[model samples]
Target: MTTQPSPSDPAAVALELERIRRTIEVGFTRTDGALALLVQRHDQTDEALKGHDRRIDDHDARLDTLERGETERQKRDIARLDALERARWPLPSVAALVAVTGLTLSLWQLAAR
Candidate 1:
């Protein structure tokens, strides 16, 4: 930009305008190149993030499967424990036998009296 020019210097003003135009063209080229690099980097980042998301989803599914398997195993273990407990105590049969023995003792004591 020519700030001031003699009235008789149209050619100089034109030349200054041309120089400014060329400078602006160069700046635009640099800006375009920088923008293109940024776009390329952004695309690469997006692809990487998408891959990570897929991996995370797969991991989550695997975890869910493992949890389900663990739950089933726990249920089977609880069933086994319950069977063991029943075998150990057999509460109903034991209670009935105890009551009958106590009755027999009481009857014997009455008879003796």
Candidate 2:
């Protein structure tokens, strides 16, 4: 429906070239806009990833603190258990003394009777 410029006409050729230049300019503009948007999105994603890294680091620190506390608690519990084991070591000696006392008392009572 449109008339195109003849290649032989200087003015028409100039006009056609101008039109092509404009079209190329528009394409470049659109590409620039898209590239700008991509760069912005990449920056935002970078910030988000940095934030996640900070959170992960914080979680790791907290877990390490909890582990250290638990390790200290386990050590204390082990020491207490060991001390209790040592305390029970004299039980057999006390039991033997009670048995000997009971036997001596029974023998003395029989002699008196």
Model 2, residue 68: displacement in angstroms? 1.2
Candidate 2, residue 94: how far the Cα is off, in Å: 8.9
Please write out the lDDT profile of model 2 over residues 16-90, one tens digit for every residue: 889999999999999999999999999999999999999999999989977776667778987999999987768
Per-candidate total of colliding backbone pairs: 0, 0
Score residue 29 of candidate 2 by CA lDDT: 100
Give each model's whole-structure lDDT: 0.91, 0.92
Please tell me which predicted candidate would have the highest TM-score against the true structure.
2
